[model samples]
Target chain A: MSNWRQMMPTTEAYLLDKVLYELHHKPDDLAAYNEDKAAYLARFRLTPELAEKISSNDVAGLYEAGVNPYLLRAHCIGMRIPEDVSLAALRSLMKEGDDKWLN
Target chain B: MAELTGIYTASHTPVMLNFPDRIPTELRTEIFGAYEAMGRDFEAGRPDALVVLSNDHLHNFFLDNFPALCIGVGESYESPIEHWLKAKRRVFTGDQAFGAYLLQEALKADFDPAFSMEMVLDHGSLTPLELAGLDPDLPIVPILFNCVQPPMPTMRRCYQFGKFLGEAIRRYDGAERVAILATGGISHDIATPRMGMVNREFDERLLQLMEAGDSEAVVAYATNQVHTAGNGAEEIRMWMAAMGAAAGLPFKRAYYRAVSDWYTGIGIGHFGENSLATVGSIDG
Candidate 1:
């Protein structure tokens, strides 16, 4: 169970991005999305490097470290990044947009 | 003839205590006195119910598409989670009849307002209730707007809604003297780098405009000058609506204080054509 949960999206950025993506495209399947996201995070183990990057406040680096930029931005700003920022930041930094997350 | 009774507008002072040094003794007395007077009126006949307009601060709604205007028609309401506010009481009842009437009137006027039966009152509502000395039992119709968050309503829309609200209250068949209260915003920022900024000059000017019953100017200023005043200045729209409801009536500036520490310009004033002198002192 611990290993499976570790593989899931544990970071706040990943959770937020998952929530946003689910809200926009597959809104009807939010329960499934949340459950799946939680499970995925539980399975995806947090690497020490990623943990250190977040703790060190390397916002951009943490995004590059396989942490969802959308989620990282939310954690950094202390609020959900506005939809515009979420879309733009994902595109410019991660080469990922709303569609990428939904898929 | 319908009796146009007391009209109250309050700024939600975030501070825990009524600091004497920050709020001058004279001003506190005057403001408290006005509230006492209003409280007395409520006890005497009380309006059929109070029509209150306040802003919601991310408690009921988030960044995802909050309505510009929403009303509570619930029979009972609770205060939101604010351990700091230290509200002395919990649970307030809503006047269903008045709420329904106001909703119908607002809709007739082309204002599409959302309704909630189970809603929580934030500091925006709690602070005004505290300052006004209102009994917890006072039946109220709560109207919440997205003032704190972005994608806010236009000043013109708020003013127009206030006008419609006044008409709605008058149209109600109930004989109870109706009082309208608008709470929140006298210049303070809660979000972003400029948090804790309070604009005394802007607040004073706003009070002056409200006293004059200059809705047009108030709306225009809200559109153009609110950002300069403070991000929280949008809460002033609630006051504009209350003023609209009491148009053509004499409004008294009962109390005014710019508490720099609290980052708020707190003021309590009343509107009623037949109310006493423009200024009076309350000794407590």
Candidate 2:
């Protein structure tokens, strides 16, 4: 009910949320984590391009593809992107005033 | 039975970590002095358990399973946040006994609050406590609210939740004295393009209502109305919870400063004793 736009429920958004949450909180077993990640991604209609963008910590790309900066910033951090590096990308994304800005 | 000894609200942000850079030295000294003053008061009250009401920074949960309100029942909590500030980090001890009782009572009251045995403490729960010099060994129950992202609960609902929580604390059979600490924003925009902006007018008005003990006026704040100030202003949900827990109690504004450089209002206050508020003093 606030001025902020509602969260996106797309596969990309779901994938990003899980990816961030898992990166910060992963299973102790490596094989189990890989298997779990596969099963989780399988549930979504994720394209290879979207997956690639996330893997690369491409925050600007994520933003352009409908991922809001709030979630994107978390993703960047979980992926271990340097603070200055990720924060710079986030700032650019917010200031872009591009069509991607849902607000 | 355990009794509510002190109820407090303070600001918690990265701004508090890098104080000299964010706030001027003159104001910073005074602001920290207030926290020390409040800390002295808290210790003198001899509280045993402190219930911290704060917001998570999307580090604990995400849009997939964002909890509106959550109670931590774990025996201990760690802060994985603050890598940026490198703020003094500590593993705060949790009060599972009191937390479990609070959870059960809230559920019985028809308020479904999520309970966690493993919850991470972020700056929201730690910043103010460390700055205020709260005894680290004191048992803590961290109650997190959804202040970021959309679909935040209304102040009315949060107040109701707080009322139930207060009742449960009062009903618990223990000799322990409990203190309620609500930590977050008065008015600051952390996410939006206006990231460093602080609304002094909104901060002042809210403080006035608290000093006059007008919780009804405080609860009347709808989500969208507060959005006009800033997204971070949403964290005032914590303050509303404090008011609800201390409803009808007289209060005093401990300190207030609109630190634009820090992107925080730096508002702190306390609720104590019962006193009838003059009706329109709140609305005006």
Candidate 3:
């Protein structure tokens, strides 16, 4: 909650990091992301369930699997996802835990 | 001895550039106009180097390891990352000698900080340069604080850091006319549900203190209290740091606006001795 902790070791943790990094520095290729998705994802040793989550681009599901939402959102910022989409997706699963502390 | 010629704080959120039309023209003029004013007057000071205080948006650092504070000590730097900003890649001269001098002096002052010779200038630093039409060739010393990732340096700690930084600059025997530019936050968040929310009241409350040179009061806000405004609003650590470096001198308002389009309250202010121009006036 203070500084980010180690990303939990899970398929989503391993695969989502790649998803976000690719989306961040090379977002133009998401369309191509699917064509070779298996080949790219194969390297992660992910189970079929986690591969599905990564390939589906389920941010909420990934978060449930311990992928940090903040890091996930960096992908949103880089990919230029619409604000409403990101808000609806993220809010469905997270409360922004620290909001009540506001003065 | 090196002299701090100017001190400034500005919003570096990139949405303002990407969606300028999202904001009403009147607000745009008011906010950017203030940036224009600051740019003109800041350049008038002809600072040999501008040290920009900002935070990385996970652009260069990650969860594996993040320094609470970092300074670029390279001979030159480039803002090459293209995903968040549309700026063309261009080389910028870095005042490494001065950066190293400040680093040594800061350590001597008891503030432990990390130093880097390689890094990219993200929107947190570059957007202000673009907004103000600042000269890229104007040698820069980029200083970054871990304002985004939380568990960051306390607001008071950041101010103290700047205070010590100012002392270091003054202690250096170099001849550079230095300026300090702190970027980001006047109450706005991004990538969170609160994205697009601007706490005008919160921004103004802090601005009032800044204008009055109340560094202690500014730092009194608990970190969570500041986050109440917005997540990215945490970048106010930059403003607090600038206030400290300014040595408690009152700053003149450059501009203040609650531009929801950028989802940032977007405030600008400047501090200078004798050269404190009137609000909204571009001192020639």
DockQ of each: 0.04, 0.18, 0.28
lDDT accuracy of residue B84 in candidate 3 = 56
Model 3 chain B — which ten-residue stretch has the worst lDDT? B275-284
Q: What share of the true interface contacts does each candidate keep?
A: 0.00, 0.17, 0.21
What lDDT tens digits, residue by residue, belong to model 2 across residues B50-129?
A: 99999888777777688988989999998746344447768888999888888888888998889899987877887788
Off by over 4 Å in 3: A1-19, A22-34, A45-54, A59-70, A90-103, B222-224, B274-284
Worst 10 residues of 2 chain A by lDDT: A94-103
State the displacement of the C-alpha of residue B246, model 3, in Å, after optimal TM-score superposition. 1.1
Cα lDDT for residue B7, candidate 3: 90
lDDT string for model 3 (A1-65, tens) is 22232323454464566556554655555556546877766756578888787677665666566
What lDDT tens digits, residue by residue, belong to model 1 across residues A1-103? 0001122344543533344333333334435534564443343344555445533445445544444322343343332344344334433542223122111
**Candidate 3 lDDT over residue span B173-277, tens digit each:** 765688889998877766554556667767777877666666677788635457568767878888878888889677777777776667777778887764445
Candidate 3 chain A minimal-lDDT segment of 10 residues: A1-10
Ranking the candidates on lDDT from highest down gives 3, 2, 1
